[model samples]
Target: MTVISIPGSKSVTARALFLAAAANGSSTLLRPLSSDDSEGFAAGLTGLGYEVVREPDRWYLTGRPCGPAAGEADIYCRDGATTARFLPALAAAGHGSYRFDASAQMRRRPLAPLTEALRTLGVDLRHEDAEGHHPLRIEAAGIKGGELTLDAGESSQYLTALLMLGPLTREGLRITVTDLVSAPYIEITLAMMRSFGVEVTRGGPGNTVFTVPPGGYRATTYAIEPDASTASYFFAAAALTGSEVTVPGLGQGALQGDLRFVDVLRRMGAEVHTTADATTVRSTGGLTGITVNMRDISDTMPTLAGIAPFASGPVRIEDVGNTRVKECDRLEACARNLRRMGITVATGPDWIEITPGTPRPTEVETHGDHRIVMSFAVTALRTPGITYDDPGCVRKTFPGFHEAFAGFAEILDRRGPATRP
Candidate 1:
């Protein structure tokens, strides 16, 4: 078995940063993910008057717990969806005249819903040239925090952001979310919030109502879990190469919903086992294709998509309509890239069906989305001759992706594309 050290969870790191900034005192985040996305979150927090000290194993912070400076707060998310969605709610809970922007790609994503929700709570939000995207400004007056209802159809981060803001509001908040997708991610948000000594109540008539009282987060030390979504790519490597791979520090007790991706692998004829400290995926035989709804674990849909051509039948990915608004149009990107590999692909408003065939040697266009880049990299294990025009796009989350993946491939490729047709 090859051993791999996965990075800390991106979801946990972002939530930790937010909670730490919202806490009344100082806090330490142990083993937070160090990536462009995470760094973007850190920068956004710093712009809001929080002081963040980055170290190798952990990050230290001095919480403002209130708001940014009075005049202007300019924060750039640099294309991280979590940062773009979560931070606005954070600012609204505090005090400021804040301006938020992102990379051109992120500007194309949906921020209107979150902005509109914030406005419902009395944020003076203004669109800067564009109607519903970034480069938007908000005069943050600290949320009045009343009962409200909104659509969570575009992204669950909207709900997660609002839920994070629940405790900070003056009157707390009662939010009813309709058309919710990726509900498990909200669980991650709630779990990390609890680690920060705050609680969000979720038992109501429709189960759609979440209540968070006026008490904000407490300053505390929190440990981050390994990135299960990132680990999924490695697990996909095992399934593709008929090798066994183990990702330590990620197991049954993990806070990430994407850890259930192993079950998806197990359903596809891979042998998966979990322990207190790690999750292991051992290749049983050939990869089998099946119909899967990736809404709950949408982050790994691209990983599964990359391996679909190696399976014997068609693989259908459903309920991932939200992915259209991610770092890129993931559905369309996958469809285009799979076609470039000489495979068959079908797409709908919320699904993709991939047919197995031998792939052609072609340079993949990453669209600068880290998931798109990393997922397609896995195909090189079975298909070989696969290359990317810009492999460094994985730096968005996994900065050392190329070197790490090369090492794993070296170990697995000692046998070279096992059981390939």
Candidate 2:
């Protein structure tokens, strides 16, 4: 088994950057992710008058506890959904005037839920391009910070953004989350806030009511874990192929909830192990399909769905309608791409059913979404001759994914790079 050192968590790094930016003093992030998304996040902070210094293996940033120094700033979010979603709340909390822009495709994504929530919080956010989507113009007067009703069914990022601003509110905040999806991410958000020195009062994944008293975050040095979402590719590779892969710096106690993707693999009869310092995945033989609802760990839906065609039975994934609003319509994208490769995929509004088939050689349309590229690459491990379009989109979260996955291929002594034409 090759022990791979995965990069730091994109989710954690993004959240950490904002928390550090709003902290009372300087906070150092040890082993933070270096990618387009995190870079965009740091750059967004820099534009808001926070100091961000990048060094080998770490990042150091100073807080803007008094809110952004600039009265106006432009944020180039590119394709980072986290950066796009989270920063708006930060802007509202800081009372900074800002304009956020993204890639052409990202402009089509729905931001109305969060934007509307911000409006409810008394932050003036308008759609500068089209109505109800990015690019948005934020004329921040700071949050009114009372009870706000939010629909997180579209994205937990909406709740995450608001939850992050809970402590910064003048009168604090009471959030009522309805139709919440990706609930585990809320847990990660609360945990990270606790590390930065504030506790978010979690009401329920059952009945989602959250209370945040007006207590601000303190500056603290933090260490980020390896990206568990990215790790799912390797885990799925192990399940699809009869080989073993281990990711160091991730384990049972990791902060990222996407680590639960391994639990799905284990359920599918993959050999999975977790110790204090590392997690390992090794194939037993072939996978047996089971129905899965991916709302909590929905990021791995494509990854798991990629490998399902080779399973013994039908694999059903559900409760991820939010995927439709991601970097692309991931549910539809997976069905289209998998069917492109001669696999049988039945897709519904919020679920997909993939049955066993001999996957044929074909090109995967990534729709410029990184998860699409990475997920299909896992399928390529078992079913060869899979080439993907817009492979560079992995830069959004995992910039070195091609290089790392190439090493993954070499370690297993498998076929050539998934990028080969």
Candidate 3:
């Protein structure tokens, strides 16, 4: 049995950094994620003239809630979607000029909906390179939040960005979402906001109307919880290899909606136990596949698909049509990767079905997506041998993913300069 204590959640870290930068005092973030994606967001803050101090494991960010210090800078978000989406709105509300751009992969990701909504709020934003895409320049202007409609069918991140910034807008914002997906992630945003002394009102099932008070963000200390999405890899490893693994910092009371994955694990014959602060999962017997509707929790689809071939029956994942717009088309990637392993996998626009097949070694390409890398790493534990290209992609979320998986599998480094012979 191996116990892995993963780092803080990337989702939480990005959101906290934004909130801390928007607050009016010095905020210290403990156990912050130090990776390319996270560092890119922190760098964006620094570019906007905010003081961001990095320690060994914690980050100290001095907030200038009024606006950025210099009031104008060029911000490059790299490949981080959280930074790309959230920073634009934060910069718009400030009294400065800013320009944002990202890598090729990020360029492919859409930002039109958020931009259009920001434009509706009177932000002076212009597309430098591609219209409805990244490489945007924004002049510091105040926002008047009123009735705004956004198309969230493509990515829930667009909606979350509006939701997070709604509280900071002048009149507070009334957001009307059309075809919103990833509802659980929105719930996470609301919960985190409330924890930091912000109130959000959900009008009804699909309609959310938020009212941000006239005052600014309330400064306070916040500790981010462990990432359930990152924990999925360890749980998958245990299920595939019949190993007992305990993941600390995740329990029955976790605010993260992805924690529901434990229910799926229990159904698949893994012994699941939860305490006040930790969740332990052990595979007691062979895995029995089950069907799951993953609309609210699409992030776990890759992890679940990676181990589906080891189950006794077919594992069906449904209602994940919006996953097409993630860092990559996850459905196609999962199917393609599983086929490489000799698994009988079928995929549709909104569903994927996987049946157990003969185990074989295969090479999986991560496509620079962190989930893809972590999910296939779980498969490496049970298969004869599996190699990954661009294993460094795990830095997007869990920078120490390879080290954590090392407790249960043999990790061979084959990358440049870091190759182990």
Candidate 4:
């Protein structure tokens, strides 16, 4: 079995950056992700006048609990929603005037819900470009938190942004979410908050009330775990090509909710073994397809779709319409990219069904989404000469994805200058 270790969780990295930026003292984070998304987040913190140091796999952030530096500045979030969403709220909490903008894809993603909620909290923010899109001009003169209703049906990152910054408000914050999706991400938020000594009370399912104490975040050293979403690609690779793959640093009891992907692998007829710190997966028999609802774990949709073509029956993925607002329209990208490989796939607004067919080798376009890049790379194990446009996009989440793939698979022409899709 080929063993591989993925980087720390992007979810964890973004949250830890926010915690460190807002903490009372300097905080050092180990094994943080160094992808484009994370880089943009770190840049945003630095642009706001916080001192940040980046190493090979660690980050040192000196907190500015009082707020970012004086003066209005433009903080470009690129296409990083975690940076775009969380940084604005953090800046607003500390009373600063800043303008936030992103790439075209991020501009299309909605930010109104979070902005409106912040407005309800007495922070002044005006949309510079589109009514509900990016290029947001935030005039932060401090905020008084109150109860607010948020429509999180489009993206859970909106609610998570609010939840993360809610404690910094004067009154604390109570969020009543309507049609909240990607619920597992919320669990990650709560868990990370508790790690930093912040407490939040869960009213019930889909209802949460947050109470940020008078004192702000306390500085603490945190070790980030391996990303389960990134691990899914290798597990899918093993299942698709009859190879034995062991992903170290990920246990069955992993904190990431996406760790349930191993169960999905088993459901597709793969043998999975779990240890205290790793999960090994291998194809047991001929793979049989099954239908699955991936609401809580939508991040795995692309990997599941990429592996579906190797199954004996049709693989159906359901309850992931919210993926449309992610870095890319994941459902549509999965279906379109699989079709590029001459696979028979069907897609709806919220579901996808793929039937195995004569797989043909073709270059896949990632739409600059890391999951799309990794998902299609798994298909290369079974196909011949499959190249990915902008393969470097995987650095957005997994900086070592190409090197990791080269360990077990034959990677052709990866050293040349990266090609944009």
Instruction: Estimate the TM-score of every prediction.
Output: 0.97, 0.95, 0.94, 0.93
Worst 10 residues of 1 by lDDT: 63-72
lDDT of 2 by residue, 248-353 (tens): 8888788877888988989988888899989998875478888998988999999988888878899999988889888889999999988888888898999999
lDDT of 1 at 225: 87
Which candidate has the highest TM-score of all? Answer: 1
> RMSD of candidate 4 to the true fold?
4.5
Residues 1-421 of candidate 1 have per-residue lDDT tens digits of: 9889999988889888988888888899999999999999998888777789999999998776565543478889897988988888888776668888998988888888788888888889998968888888888778778988878877888888888888888889898877788778888988888888778888667788888888777899989888999999999999888899999999778888899988888988899989999999998448888999899899899999999998878999999998887888899999999998899999999999999898887888888889988898888877678888788888888999989998999997676558764
For candidate 4, lDDT tens digit of each residue in 67-113? Answer: 78756779999888899899998899776679999988889888888
Provide the lDDT at 245 for model 3: 72
Task: Give me the displacement of residue 10 in model 2, in angstroms.
Answer: 0.9
Tens-place lDDT per residue, model 3, 174-200, is 877767777778777878777666787
RMSD of 1: 1.3
Off by over 4 Å in 1: 69-71
**What's the lDDT for candidate 3?**
0.81
Candidate 4 residue-wise lDDT at 7: 82
The reply for model 3, stretches above 4 Å from the true place, is 204-207, 410-421
